[model samples]
Target: MYCRNCGNEVSEKAIMCVACGTPPLAGNRYCPNCKAETSPDAGICIRCGVGLINTSNHSEFDWLTTLLLCLFLGTFGIHRFYTKSIGIGIVQLLTLGGCGLWTLIDFIMIVVGNFRDGNGKVVVNKQRA
Candidate 1:
């Protein structure tokens, strides 16, 4: 592997670059796979032809689908299904009307990315702002 901060060779599993005292993969100045210089905005390393990982700090959420489901079928746990909360959705449906308040609260939380899927992974919304 290579140190992204200084383009120096480093251990593949190294968490920090000893030469530059920086996290190995914390920068976009070089390719981790080939140690070749790369453009800051480049997605693939030209020398190794390997895709670079973009570690952007952003949570993935499905806004449109969640909003629609919450507005249209929130009473029946459709939004829960859309968000992959099948057990909660089924319980909401089976309870007849016990989950209405819970589902409404879930709608708000989903819009804000507080609600996650069953795997506890945030849903990645691909819509551009």
Candidate 2:
């Protein structure tokens, strides 16, 4: 992969670009997939035909916190709220977590690391609360 900000080659798992001191996907000046120069407003890379996504602003939600919320306050949809799933949270809140069945399923999903946030990004597996 390439850093979108500086067109520098970077590892796929790199959090930030070493050359530019910025998140690897932060800029639209270059294509992260092919290192091709791209327009700032372009949505997809012309050379590689890959969608350009700016993931620099994405927040890494803690997996442990979500698990704890689901275990302790899932009846109130607290875990859904923490994951920014407000609509589902409201539904869970009104239904009392589908009479506790939905909460149990959510607990299992979180434990198995299949839970996702509002943006469909997986929760970070950090031990922090």
TM-score of each: 0.47, 0.64
lDDT of each: 0.71, 0.84
Error of 2 at 53 (Å): 13
- Tens digit per residue, CA lDDT, model 2, 1-129: 999899999999998889998878877688988889998767788998999855532336778889999999999999999999999999999999999999999999888767878867666564531
User: Model 2 shows how many backbone clashes?
Assistant: 0
Predictions: Cα RMSD each: 11.8, 5.3
- Against the true structure, candidate 1 has what lDDT? 0.71
* Candidate 2 residue pairs in clash (backbone atoms < 3 Å): none
Candidate 2 segments exceeding 4 Å error: 4-6, 10-15, 18-21, 25-33, 36-59, 126-129
For candidate 2, the 10 contiguous residues with the lowest summed lDDT are: 53-62
Task: State in Å the error of residue 16, model 2.
Answer: 2.5
